[model samples]
Target: MDLYIFCRMVLQQKALILLVTVVVAALASAYAFLVRPEYQVSSVLRPAAINELDALNRSEIYQLPSGDALIKVGASLESYETRLGFFRANQKLFKNFERPGRTLEQSFEEFNYNSIKLVVPDAKNAGSLNAYIKLVMNYPEGVAGVAILNGFVQYAIESQRQQIAADMEVIVRNRLSELAGRLDSARSSYVTDKAAKIAKLTEEDNLKRAQLQDELKALRAQLKNQRADQIAQLNEAIGIAKSLGIQKPSTPSSLGGAGVQGSQPVMRTEVNNQQIPLYFMGVDALLAERAALLQRKSDDFTEARIAQIAKELQLLQANREVEVLNQRKNEDLFLSGVQPLRAEEVRLRNLNVDMSGLKLVTIDKKAIDPLGPVKPKKMLLIIIGIVFGLMLGLVAAFVRGTDQSRRENSSDTTLLPHSSIPAKKALLSNVEAL
Candidate 1:
């Protein structure tokens, strides 16, 4: 129950307790002495700016540069771990040969697998990994551990870099190709539509020009005909007046005297029952003929010319407005639709190429050889041994004391039943045996 009582019980069976304690302690001490000491060597590597630099060089359209780099790093680590198993197997060189009965292979296997602790520290405590890596690489012994670790790290980094390069190149190239295809299609459509529009506008412009020319020519002919008719009519009126015996006033005084004389007959020429005054009739007919010519010129010549000119001008204006509108539409489409799309296509193509390049990148040394064994910490082993020995000693003491108590209780029980019978026989037997 209590420690004191337990100790007293063990003391009562001191011989057996002492024997068991000695055996357990000796066995535990021997085990601790025979076990090999192990040292830990680790290394750390920070994700470099190599991926970012590569992306910048390749293209401006990076979707996830940082995420890509992290993914590459993780994949590289996985590959390294998988490939380094063979290197870990070679840790037998570090095994101590002081124990001839144990092979280095057997001892090394025990140390390598269960003992080694390869840790990747958190970002905040990443310095620890770096320190560990440096220690392993720089370990004094020219052992397989260091060689393997160096090889693994070098190969892994190189492989990862190559793969990233290849991937970047592929991605950029593919994107560019896709963009090029789209641009080609757009260019073809634009060329086709432009040709059609140009043809239509040219035809309309030619027709308007022809119509204006025809209308102008007809107006000129009409004007010439009206002028000829007016001239003929004027000449005839002058002749008729001459034939009717009408005297022309030679002087302003004569004309005024004629107008004042009441007895002067109003000289009239009658034609087709229409009386024409001999004095003013010729002048009136000439004025009417001139007005008719002027009216014909205004109607057929001047007005036709103005109307044709206005129509032609309107067509020209429409054509110019259409050209201007088409030009603006073309420019807007180029800037808003085509140019940006083309630029994007080019950008994506470049990025794809970059990603392809990254994919081809390879680590020169994926893993490094650990310079020292990464197992069986010596002080820890010794401390563990001591603890094991104490526990075994206590257990041995308890077992020995429990066996001793059983023997004592059996002896007391047998003696209690035999005590009365043995008392009567004790006197006779004591006398006879004496």
Candidate 2:
């Protein structure tokens, strides 16, 4: 175990050490040159600007903030489903992962799980205002990493935009349908109210007409009775005038009782009164009044109130309120609440949020061609190979040295008993040759 002796022993096996080092170094170099290297390609994404989302935010129906858009894009980037979909769509870009035993599905799974990565700010710096997402892909040779990154980003954004559009469409349709339903309900209510008003007017008119007719009949009956009484009183006066032999309408003072057969002499006196009695009027005038009263057809014309009641009944035959309601050209004008709802519906229907060029997230940095592969550091590998070869060569040299020393000792021990000077000299010579 002396350092000088071990050095000599190692030098004795210098050819073996040289052969082992050269072989190991050559194998490392071959492997380094032959294995495919993976290159790193990445893109950075940031939240969109306010101006970019202005069109979508202008309407009250829906609102989307820039931060939310960034979150959605980031989530899409991190989704396994999204990566798998991208892999399936761009299989040609990932054909290099395919091998004899691996099916396309397995290769895609490997690529999706291992190759693609989303780099986000750590929890400590996650809440920073400058939050971003970095999409990284380590691709093998023959694959277009930059193209895949760019295409996947575009695809994700487009997918999110389409989803937003579809959601807006559903919202508009539902709102419009709800508005339409309200309009229908309002129309029905308006119609029902109108019909009820008409019915009410009709009932009032009928009742008024019936009351007017009853009043007219009562007035006519009263007038007819008065006429009959007047005629009966006139006949009685005529009889009395015949008995007294009065032949003309005359004042009571003008009447003289110059009758024969036990009649007393009459005394005349003047009396002033506004009305004269029917009996006091002469037989000829009374008879004429009675004849006229008996020949009368209707008593309605005699009373002024009867004429007024008839006119009212004629007017009530047609309800002017009902006529106006039925003749209305624009019934919607009356529904004050409905018009505002209609206006709102029209505004909503006219709303247009154009998302043709909608950009959800800003691409701070797009993927570009890498200058070189990130893995398989050639110089590092060569250095490691050289170190490993030197260590193995030392181990082999130590083993050979130990075995040669043990054999020299054993041969000396076994040959010493019968050894001559010549044998001893020969053994010494053999040891020197070794």
Best by lDDT: 2
**Model 1 per-residue lDDT tens digits across residues 203-314:** 8887877777777767667668767775676667656656643344232333335556576566544334554433335555565666667656345434546575766757
- Which parts of model 1 are misplaced by more than 4 Å? 1-40, 47-59, 63-143, 174-193, 220-434
TM-score of 2: 0.85
Per-model lDDT? 0.54, 0.83
* lDDT measured at residue 137 in model 2 versus the true structure, 0 to 100: 90
* Top TM-score prediction, candidate number: 2
TM-score of candidate 1 against the unseen true structure? 0.47
Clashes of 1: 84
The TM-scores of all predictions, comma-separated, are 0.47, 0.85
